[model samples]
Target: MEAIAYERATNIADAVKAAREPGTAFIGGGTNLLDLMKGGIAHPLKLVDITHLRDDGLDAVRALPDGGIRIGALMRNSDAANHTLVRERYPLLTQALLAGASAQLRNMATIGGNLMQRTRCPYFYDTAFAACNKRAPGSGCAARDGYQRLHAILGASEHCIAVNPSDMSVALAALDANVQVVGPDGARQIPIGEFHRLPGDRPDVDTTLRPGELITGVDLPPSRLADRAYYLKIRDRASYAFALVSVAAALQVQGDKVAAARIALGGVAHKPWRASIAENVLIGRTLDDETLREAAAAQMRDARPQHGNRFKVALAERGIVRAVNVAAGREPAGVTGAPA
Candidate 1:
C-alpha cells in the first residue's frame, strides 16, 4: 500500500467528523482496513484511527432495562465468546467464535470489525481483476458464473452473490442481537437481522449504515432457549478457514415437541441465511428423521447452486438435519472435520 495520511480520533465526535469526509474511513482493529488497503481494494485518502475512541466498556456485558445485553463494539471476539453471559446464554455464539480463525486472531479482531469485514470473494479482493460488482458497482460480478463455492443461494442479484463471512454474526442473528450505532444524526438501534441487507439490486452496499454512522455497540438479547443453543460449521480444514456450510440453531424442545426454533445458516447466502421456512416447519413437530428431513428440505426449496459447489445442497441438508438433532436433545452424532 502507498503511504496514506493517518489520524487518530480520541472520541466519537471527532471520529464521526473525520469519517464523514470523502475518502476517509475509520480504523478499529485495522484487521480489515489494512488488508483492504494493502490489496488496493480500499483506497481511503485518510485513515482515521478510531480504535482508542472505542474504549467504552467493550469488555463487559451488561443487562439492559429492556431485557437486553449491551456489548461494546471494540470488544474482542475471544472475550465475547468466553464471557460468562455468552457461555451460559449464547452458547452457539461461543461455539461459532471458537470454530473461527484462531485465538490470536480472535484477540486482535474486534466484534465490530468482524461484522464489517469485506467479502472473501477472491475476485473482489484482487485489484488486478477488472470486474467485481462489490469493488466497483455496475462493473459486473465475476462470481456470477465463476467460482462460487462460498456464494449465496438466497437473496442473490445480478450484481453480486458473495456471502457475508461472519460466524459470530450468524449466531447473533439466531439470538436476535441488536446493533447500536452513533452518527451525526444521533444514536440509534438496529436489529441484527436488519443490520445487514440483501443483495436486492445493488449488492455493492452491504449494510444500511448511513453516512458518518459508526457501529458503537451491539445489544444481545437474553434467551432462555439459547442455553441449549449450538453452532456447527463445516469447513475445508480443521484450522483457520471459512465455513463451507454452517448452522447456528437455538431450539426449545418440550417432550419431543419443539416449542420454538431459531435457525440461521452461513456460507450459503448474501446475509446470514435464516431458515425461516424450516423454523416454521419445526416449531411444533417432533425431531424424527422424517420431520428433520422435511424441515431441512423446506429451507432449501428454492436453492440454486453452481457446478463446483452443487454438493453444498446435500451438505447443507445434512447440516440442517444434524443441527435439528442437537435441538431435539440428542448429542450430535459423529460430528467430524469441524462443528457439524
Candidate 2:
C-alpha cells in the first residue's frame, strides 16, 4: 500500500472539501477500497472518511410519504437488509443483499460502498498482468483473450469485459432506485439505471459520479412487486462464491396477467444489466411457463459471450426464466451452484 493521510470529516461539507484535493478518495466501509490499495491497484494520497456525514443522516432507513424507501449511504448492508421498511417494502433488495458476502463482511459493508464496489475480474487484481484496461487505461483487456468464464456478455467494449459484482445494485436497478449525491458543486440525483455506466471507451469510470461526489442515499420508488419478488444466484459454490449468473425478478400480477415486471441481471455486464426488453415481452401477458421462456429469450437475444463464457448465455436464460417464475408464484426459490 502507498503512504496515505487520513482525515475523518465531521460533516458532509468538510468531506466534500477534502475529497476535492487531487489524488483523494472517500473511505466508506473500506471493504473494496482497502483491497484495491493492498493490491496496489489504487494509490490515493489522501483519504477523506465520510462514513459519518451528518447533513444527510447517513445511517437511517426511513419510509417516504410517497410510499418509497430512503436508505442512507452509511447504512450497513446487514442492517439495511434487515430493516423493517426494507424487508416489508423491498424484499428483492433484501434478498439480493443477503445473497452477497458472509455475515461478518455484510456487517461492515455500507450501502454507498456496496454500490461503489469494484469488479472481481482476476486480471484486474493481479498486478503481474499489465494489460488490464481498468487498471492501466489503453494497455488492453487481458480477459478478452484470457480466462473469461466470469466476464461480461453484454454492454462490453473492445477495451474491457469486466462485470459489476454488486447484487444489491442489480436489485436497485429493477426497483427504479435513485441515488442522491453531494459534491463540491452541491447536490444532484442520478437514476439508478443511469448511475453505473457501460464500459464504452472509458472503462476506468465505473459510475457516473464525478470526482469528490459522495453518494448520500438511495431512493426506491413505489412499487407493488414487494410481495412478488425473487433473487436467484448461480455460482461455482453453494455459498461464499461470486455469482456467475444472478437475476433479480419482480412482478406485479393482476389476477393471472402480468401488470408490471422488472428483471435485472448481475455478473453479465459492466453495470446492472436491466432486462427491459424482456420486461416489455411480459407486461399485460398471461403469466405462465411459455411467457417466462419468451421473456428470458428476449433478454438473451443480444448477448455476445466470448470463448470460455458462452455457457453464461444459456445459464442466464435459465436463471431469468426461473427468477420470473418464482416471482410470479409459479416456482420455488432456492440457492446454490445451479439456477433456482
Candidate 3:
C-alpha cells in the first residue's frame, strides 16, 4: 500500500473542504475504498474520513412531507434495507439490497459507497492485464475480444464493455429516485436514471458527478408505483453472487391490465439500465406471458452480444418477462429462465 495522509472530518463542511484538494477522496464505510487501495487500483494522497458526519442526520432515513423518503448517504445498507419505512414502503428496494453482498458486508457498506462501487470486470481488477480501458484510458479493452461472459450487451462502446455491479443501483433506477450532492458550488440534485454514464469513448468516468462533490443522500419520490414491485436476480449461485442478469420490475396495474410500469436491468451494461422500451410496450397491455415476452424481446432487440456471452441476451429477455409477470402477480415465485 502507498503511504497516505488520513484526516477524520469533524463535519460535512470539513469533509467537503478536504475532498476539494487534488488526489483526495471521501471515505464512508471503507468497504470499497479499502479494497481499491489494497489492490493498488486507487492511489489517493489523502483520505477524508466522513463516517463521523452521521450527527448531521446523514445516517437517518426519514419520511418527507410529500409521501416520499430521504435516505442519508452514510446509512448502512443493512440498516436501510431493514428499516421499517423502507421495507414497508419500498419492498423492492429492500429485496435488492438484501440480494447483494453477505450480511456482514451489508452491515458495513454505506448507501453512498454502494452507489460508488467499482466494476467487477476481471480485466479492470488484475494488474497483470494491461489492456483495460477503464483502468487506464486509451490503453484498450481486453474484454472486447477476450473472455467476456459477464460483459454488457447494451450501451457498450468499442473502448469498454464493463458492467456496473450494484443491485441497489438497479432498484434506484427503477424507482426514479434522485441523488443529492453537496459541493463547492452549493448543492444539486441528479436524477437516479442519469446518475451513471455509458462507457462511451471515455470509459474512465463512471458517473456524471463533478469533482469535489459529495453525495449527501438519496431522495425517493412517493411509492405509488412500487406497491407491486419485484427484484429478480439470476446468478451462477443461489446466494452471495454477482448477478448474471437481474431485473427490477414495478407496475401500477388496473385489474388484469398494466396502467404504468418501470423496469431496470442490472449486470448488463456500464450502468443500471432502465428498460424504457419494455416499459413503453407494456403500458395498457394485459399481464400475460405472451405480452410480457413481447415486451422483453423488444427491450433486447438491439442487444449486441459477444462470442462467449450471447446467452446473456436470452437470459436477460427471459428474466425481464418473468420479473414483470411476478410483479404483476400473474405468475408465481421461483420460476427461472424461459419456458422450454
Candidate 4:
C-alpha cells in the first residue's frame, strides 16, 4: 500500500476540506477502503478519517416533507437493519441487510460505505492482473471473456461488465430510496435509482459521486408499495459468499390482483437492476405462478449474458419469481435457488 497521510476530522466541514485535496478520500468504516488499499486497488495520497466526526456522522432517520425516511449516511448497516422503524416500515430492507455479509461486518459497515463498495470482479481484486478497467482506467476488462460467472447481464457496455455487490441496494432501489449529497456547492438529493450508474462508456466511474462530494444521507420515500415486499439472495454458499442472483420485490396485493409492485435485481447488473417491466405487469394482474413466470421472463428480455454467466439469466428469473411470491405471501414454490 502506498504511504498516505491520515487526518482525523472533528466535523463535516473539516472532513469535506480534507477530502477536497486531490487523490484524497473520506474514510467512514475503513472496511472497504483498507481492504482495497492492502490489495493495491486503492492507494490514496490522503485519508480523511470521518468516523470520528460524531455530529456529521450519518445518524438519525426522520420523516421528511416528501413522506420519506431521511437516513443519515453514517448509520451502520446493523443499526439500520435492526432499527424498529426500518424493520416495521420496510421489512424488505431489513431482510436485504441480513442477507449481506456477516453480522460483524454489518456492524462495522456504514450506509454510505455500503453503497460505495466496489465490484467483486476477481480481476479487479488481483493487483497483478492488467485488465481491470475499474482498477486502472483504459486497462481493459478481462472479465469480459475470462471466468465471469458473476458478471453482469444488463446495463453493461463494451468497456465494463462488473456487477455492483450490494443486496441492501436492491431493496432500497425497489423502495425508491433517494441519496442526499453534500459538497462544496451545498446539498442535493438524488433518487436512489439514478444514484448508481451503469458502466456505459466509463467503466472507471462506478457511481454518480463527484470528487470531494460526500454522501450525507439516504432518503426513502413513503410507499404503500413497500408494505408488502420481500428480499431473496442466492449465492454459491449458504453464508458469507457474494450473491449469484438476488431479488428485492415489493407488492401491493388487492384481493387476488396486484395494485402495484417494485422489483430490483442484484448480481446481474452494473447497479441494482430494477425490473420495471415486471412491475408494470403486476399493476393490474394476479399474483400467480403463470403471471410471475411471464413477468420474470419479461424482466430478462434484453439480458445479454457473458462467457461464463449464462446461468445467471435463468437464476435471475427464478429469483424474481421466488422473491415476488414471498412478497405476495406465497410458499415460494419451485424456487430452485439457495434460501436467503
Candidate 5:
C-alpha cells in the first residue's frame, strides 16, 4: 500500500478547497474508493473526509418545497432506503438500494459513494492485465474478448465494454433525478441522465463532474408512479451479486391504458440507460403481453451484444417486460428470468 495523507473537512467549502489540490479525493463512506486504492486502480495522495459535514445538512434527507425530495450526498444507503419519505414516496429507489450489495455494505455506503461506484470488470480491477482502456487509456480493452459475461450490451464503445455498477442510479434515472454539485465555479444541478456518460472514445471519463466537484445531494422531482413502480434485478445469485440485467419501471395508468411510463436499465450499459423508446411505445397503449414485448423489443432493437453475452439480449427483453408488467399491476412481483 502507498503512504497517504488524510484531512477531516469541516464543511463543504473546506472539502472543496482541499479537493482543489491535485491528487486529492473526497471520501465519504470510502466503500468503493478504498477498494480502488487497495487494488492500485486509484491512487490519491490526500483523502478529504466529508462524512462529518452533517451541520451543513449533507447527511439529511429532506422533502423539497416543490413536492420533491433532496437526499444529502453523505446519507447512508440503508438510512435513505428506510427513510419515511423515501419508503412512502419513492419506493422504487428504496427497492433498488436494498437490491444492491449486502446489508453491511449498504449500511456503510453513502448515496454519493453509491453514485460514484466504478465498474466491476475484472480487466479494470486487476492491474496485471495490460489492456484495459478504462484503466490505461489507449490500451486495448481486454474484456472485449475475455470473460465478457458481465460486459455491456448497449451503449458500449470499442475502447470499453464495462457496465455501470449502480442499482440506485438506475432507479434515479427512471425517476428523473438531478445531481447537485459544488466546485470551483460554485454549485450547479445536473440532470441524472446527463451526469453519467457512455463509453465513447474517452472511456476513462465516467461522469460529467468537473475536477474538484463534490456531489452535495440528489433531487428527485414529484412523481405519480409511486404506486405503480417496480425495481427488478437479475443476478447470478439471490444475494450479494452484481446485476446481469436490471430494470426500473414506473407507469401511470388511466382506466385501462397507460398515461405515462418511465423505464431505465442497469448492468447493460456504461451508464443507467433510460429506455425512451420503450416508454414512448407504452404511453398510450394498454398493458398487454404483446404490447409489453413490443416495448421491450423496441428498447433493445439497437443493442449490440458481444459473443459471450448474447443471452443478455433476450434476458434484458424479458426483464423489461416483466418489470413493466409488475409496475402496471398486470403481473405479480416475483423472479421470472433465467440467470445470465
Candidate 6:
C-alpha cells in the first residue's frame, strides 16, 4: 500500500472542494476503492471521507411526492435491500442488491460505492500483466485475446472488452433510476442508462460523472412492474462469485399481453446493457416460448463475442429468455443464490 493523506469532510460542499484537488477520491464505504488501493490498481494521494455527511440526507431512504423512492448514496447495500419501500415497490433492486457479493460485504458496501465499482477483469486487477487499457490508457487490452470467458460480448471497442461487474447497476438500468450528483458546478441527475460508460476509445473512464462530482443518491420512478420483476445471475458457483451472465427483467402486463418491458443485462458489456431491442420485441406480444425466444434473439443480434467468450453470447440469450419468462409470469422464479 502507498502512503496517503485523509480528510474527513463535514459537508457535501467541502467534500467536493477537497476532491477537486488532483489525485483525490471520495470514500463512502471504501469497499471497492480500498481493495483497488491495496492491489496497487488505484493510487490516490488523498482520500476525502464522505461517509460522515449524513446531515445532508446522504444516508437515508425517503419517499418522493410522485410515489417514487430516493435511495441515499451512503446507505449500506444490505439496508437498502431490506428497506420497506425497496422490498415492496422495487423488488428488482432488492433482488439485485442481495444477489451481489456476500452478507459481510453488503453490510459494508454503500450504494454510491457499488455504482462506482470497477470491472473485475483479471487484466485490470493484476498489475504484473501490464497490458490493461483500463489500468493504463493507450497500453493494450490483454483480455482481448487472453482469458475472456468473463469478458464482454456487447458494446466493446478494440481497446477494451471488460464488463461492468455490478449486479445492482444492471437492476438500476432496468428500473430507470436516476443518479443524483453534486460537484463544483452544482447538482444534476444522470439517467441510469447513461451513468456508466462503454469501453470506447477511453476505456479508463468508467462513468459519465464529471471531475469532482459526488453521487449523492438515486431516484427510482414509480412503476407497475414491481410485482412482475426478477433478477437472474449465472455464475461459476452458487455464491460469492462474479456473474458470467445476469439479467434484470421487469414487465408490465395488461390482461394476457405485455404493456411494457424493462430488461438490462450484466456481465456482457462495459456498462449495464439496457435491452431495448428485446423490450421492443415483447411489447403487445404474448408471453409464449416462441415470443421469448424471438426477444432473446433480437437482444443478442448485435453481440460481438471475443475468442474465449463466444459462449457468453448463447449464455446471455438463454439468460434473457429465462429472466423475461419469470418476469412475465410465464415461468416460476427460481432461487437466485443466497441473499446478502
For residue 83, what is the lDDT in candidate 2? 97
In candidate 2, how many Å is residue 275 off? Answer: 0.3
lDDT of 4 by residue, 203-293 (tens): 8787888788888888887878656777888888766788989889888888888988889999999899889998898789877889899
Give the per-residue lDDT digits (tens) of candidate 3, residues 1-340. 4789989987777888888889998899988888878887888999999988845569999999999999999999999999999998898899899989888999999999999998989999888899988988989999988999889999999999999999999999999999999888889999998899998999989999888899999999997766788899888876677888999999998887788999999999999999999999999988777888899999999999888899999999999988887887778856332122
Give the per-residue lDDT of model 6 (tens digit) for 1-340. 4689999999888999999989999998998998999899999999999988845568879999999989999999999999999999999999999999999999999999999999999999999998999999999999877999999999999999999999999999999999999999999999998899998899999999999999999999998999899999999877788889999999999989999999999999999999999999999988898998999998999999998988888988999998988887778886875221
Clashing residue pairs found in predicted model 4: 58-74
User: How high is the lDDT of residue 183 in model 1?
Assistant: 90
What lDDT does the true structure give each of the candidates?
Answer: 0.81, 0.91, 0.89, 0.85, 0.92, 0.92
| C-alpha positional error of residue 289 in candidate 2 after TM-score superposition, expressed in Å | 1.7
Q: Is candidate 4 or candidate 5 better by TM-score?
A: 5
The list of candidate 6 runs beyond 4 A from truth reads: 338-340
Which candidate model has the greater TM-score, 1 or 3?
Answer: 3
Number of clashing pairs per prediction, in order: 0, 0, 0, 1, 0, 0
TM-score per candidate, chains pooled = 0.94, 0.97, 0.97, 0.95, 0.98, 0.98
Q: Residues 202-303, candidate 1: write the lDDT tens digits.
A: 877888888888888888876778655767889888768888898988898887688899999989887898888999998888778898899999888888
Tell me how candidate 4 scores on lDDT: 0.85
Deviation in angstroms for 271 in model 5? Answer: 0.2
lDDT of 5 by residue, 247-285 (tens): 999988999999999999999999999999999999988
